[model samples]
Target: MISHAKIPFVVFETEPENAQRARDWNFGIHWSVPLLQDLMPPELFAKLASTRVDPHRPVQPSETLRFLNGATGIEIGAAFIPHLYRVQRSKLRALLAEGIPIQYDKAISTISYTEDGSTVAAHFEDGTTVSGTILIGADGTRSKVRNLLLGEEKAALDRLEYAALWVQAKYTAEQVKYLRSGHPLFLACCHPLGYFGWLGTHSAPDQDVPEEWVMNCYISYKEPIAEQEKCKKWPNEGNLGEVKALAELCFAEPFKSAFGWLGDEQEVWYSPLTQWDPSLPEHQWDNHSGRVTLAGDAAHPMTYQRGQGANFAIKDSLELVNHIGSFLDSETKGRKEAVRVYEQETKERAGEEVRLSYQNTEMVHVWEKVLQSPIMKHGLNPTS
Candidate 1:
């Protein structure tokens, strides 16, 4: 959106390389929020539509959707409800080359400024600094920038007892043939023993040699006791056996086979879900100061249950864009007012989304409950 607006901005990316490969994609979303479609311009929408995995894919995101049973391997609930789409982050990264100045390897250590809101500077761990009129922390959940801005080494997070087992492995020919195996979109299941799992697939231009795409599998469950006992778990410790054993507890049969499906080169990351307060009290963007602000996960770190983490960030840019025209009006206090309005509106809307996600995290853990929940029942029909 910034690129399309012809805005001149500098982005600091800690990752040396783009985390997304050519075929890799993520962010399965439904337009639960109303303002998204109209805010997107035609050209941008066209580009997104062109990337659909299949030509026959739905033109509009639907409110109706279905879930696969990990136990019986059968799909359940209403089909084609939530008009949804599987979007790749790489597509957006491709836009950055359009004159966006991104400084890689420049991780921000701390951000400081004068009390009077002048001379805002971002200090890097390597002793580098970037001074600007304003700073936006788009760093993500464990945002270092947000941590410094909020005056805490550890940003406040609500740790949910719902732990997840996430693993990325390569796909096989047979695996790929299972069209219903959950690819291009999301395939999910909730086990009666108290766990939910989802499968998503991705392909990149880099698949020339192996002709394989990447498969991501996640199993989330309420494990209050096990989760609270440790700060971190086996995934970080690189204990494959323990992680597999844990999955066995929440999955059954072929779904258990999904565990064995762990590719030889596994990049497993196990962790519990965490949330950030949407009240925006912890870090407020002052119109008078307007030196520091945050966007995306840094601002509202909700669970992926609603797929709003990325969507909200995109919506935030729209909010910023709405205020940009006036803010750039140098003759008046437009910029300050713009900051105030954007932050105000963003916080209110994001707060609601954060709260909803918290509820969704609970409902999804229980299959029967999610089936009747609005998420599984409602489709994003514009008319509705």
Candidate 2:
């Protein structure tokens, strides 16, 4: 889970009462309270391992707020967890509990779309079928569902010309001690080449021993590599030569050591970072077609620079559910009315988000332009 630790600094500088007032007026009354933190660093992980607190214990907003104030330099009015593994796991469990049939091996072959409207049917590779009132394409960048809906072999997901390599390995006891000696729960080291890297430890809820902890090394760079060639040229693609070469060029000394320690010849996973074109009309869907609808990445797949993909997905779901509820409440209204309303609102809101997300991508990759903006300086600088 990615947590923003910059909100408290903004709130503190502005005075907590003023911050609460601003939030109450613009974000509704429920957002008035100061954010707090509950997770207590490595100690919390220790307790979870010892059964001091339930592994399923709900994470409080305060813990995150505190972390933000003390850690990041940015001042933010809000802090959000972009991807909550626990929430996803809980939802999966709930689906299983409700007796919904789950298919693990079967991949979706195609999405059948009506010639005139929004109702979509999915055909699995296993020859099974499922229909939905609304088709939400939460599927990632290479969304087969999107291709089927548009009746095209390719949808307009633009490659940002960047790649990310993520690795996981066990840290020795001494190394672990060194890492946590003075640092808090989270730490990120910025690379000189515009690449950002993070190393952290997340406790496995199911594990019983501290030595069995998992350490993560996430690194990203703006270098384009063919998907097929990536696998063959790197550790998985060929040998450790290419991986080490790229790693050495993108990372500094300690990180290079860390990368080498993690794996010398093992297959390293590589993902090409891509973004959607905000100016392209293909990204926009008209509700004029009636029942056919789209949500999440299907609607707007932006760059991950802002870390807003999953958060926006959840926001889309919430808005969709609300619109659905209102449509159902109106006895005389047709489903098309609901779809139209939802599309209109979603398009306007999501379009802006997509545009901003793309702009953020540019800001990260081209910091010179981003830093020149007045608003960016204010919100991005905690001491401002």
Candidate 3:
């Protein structure tokens, strides 16, 4: 429902993925079924829903990675990806249609706001500067804009003792049958062993060929992120020898079998989970003038628990889109208050979500605690 026409804003995307937007929906509005149901037309919603593989579930303790009953009736996640290139390209296309300019592969080094807080300048690594009346920091987790505004010490991330290696691979019919039996998407906890994991599939770009299913998998354990970083490995990149070995070693049978599907030499993506701890440095902001702010992970980074991280991001952008006009109208004194309200609401909502997700992350890794989690129990039932 968001129309870019509302504001003549240009998007600057910097990526480890190189400006790609992902073609797969990841999991799309299915994460928040009821809420999206209210927003999207029935037909459109149904179309997205049709892409959903019902009955995502959990792994039961077994020496071989056994899956549990997927009887729980709820969708756990959703995504709306249109290929990394296509998304930005489409945005560029839209911008072109409206005569808006966009640039890519531009590394932003710092952001500076003028004296009166009336205009902001983004200094790119290429020694180029772009000025605008307002700045929305959607640069992501290690956001330069955020650090420039809040100061690195204050905006620092609080790393959890857990890390995970996630990957997507082609699912075989036999594998799908076994996985679907327990739950298409579900988690299993190794408990005392300090490990946990989840597996699920989303509709793929080339699904038409063989109706392929992409297994989205995660395996995490209690390990200090700093310890891992000391090894010169960011969360997004890891050697299979470390995290992968941990998975096979900690998980039982069926769980082991599940993870066994991971590629051997082709190192999969891995990173330690982190949350934006508002309590740290009191979660203060530097952009007091309200002319600059942030959205998405740059605004309130948290776990993808129940898909809240992504949903919160969407909500943040939507809220700004709705209130942006206030900031555009120079005479509107309420713009400051509007930004405050947005940040305040986002913080409250996302803070609790971050905390709960941190707690949830812990539960996922612990064997005993996971068995008692509402998420595991309710099986992602929308109400739960």
Off by over 4 Å in 3: 1-5, 15-101, 171-173, 185-192, 207-213, 225-254, 279-281, 326-333, 371-384
For residue 252, give model 3's deviation from the true position in Å: 4.8
Q: 1-384 in candidate 3: lDDT tens per residue?
A: 333315677777564324445433353233343443443445554444233333222222211223232222223322222211111122222322233355776778887778875788888888999998678888777777778877787777777777767665665667656654554444443435655566655433343432376666666667776676764454333455565566566655445555665556534666677778543447768555677888878877877544455556656766776667555554765667778878877777767767767776776565557655534543323221
lDDT of 1 by residue, 1-384 (tens): 434354457888887766644234477545533345544554565555444433244556453344767676677664463555565566545633444477877888877787765658889977999888778888888877767766553466777778776766665656544533444455667766667776655433343433365656677878784654563644443545555675566565445666665644566666678888657565553434666777888888998765667677777867766566456644776555667777777778888778777777788777668676445644322112
- The sequence of per-residue lDDT tens digits that candidate 2 reaches over residues 1-384 is 013211110000112221222111000101211110121223332232122111334444322211111123232223233212222222222322232233444457766667655465767777877666555555655666566666553465766666666655556655655543333233344343456554444443433443455455556656655663555355454434554565566654445554655555444566566665423566554443454566777777876544455445555655666566666567987677777777777677666766676565555444344343222433211121
TM-scores for candidates 1 onward, in order: 0.80, 0.64, 0.72
TM-score of 1: 0.80
- Which predicted model would earn the best lDDT? 1
Can you tell me which runs of candidate 1 are displaced by over 4 Å?
Answer: 1-6, 17-25, 29-46, 49-64, 79-84, 114-119, 179-184, 204-211, 225-231, 235-254, 263-265, 280-288, 330-333, 377-384
Q: Global lDDT for candidate 2?
A: 0.47
Rank candidates by lDDT, best first.
Answer: 1, 3, 2
Q: Rank the candidates by TM-score, best first.
A: 1, 3, 2
TM-score of 3: 0.72
Cand. 1 Cα-lDDT = 0.63
Q: Which candidate is the best by TM-score?
A: 1
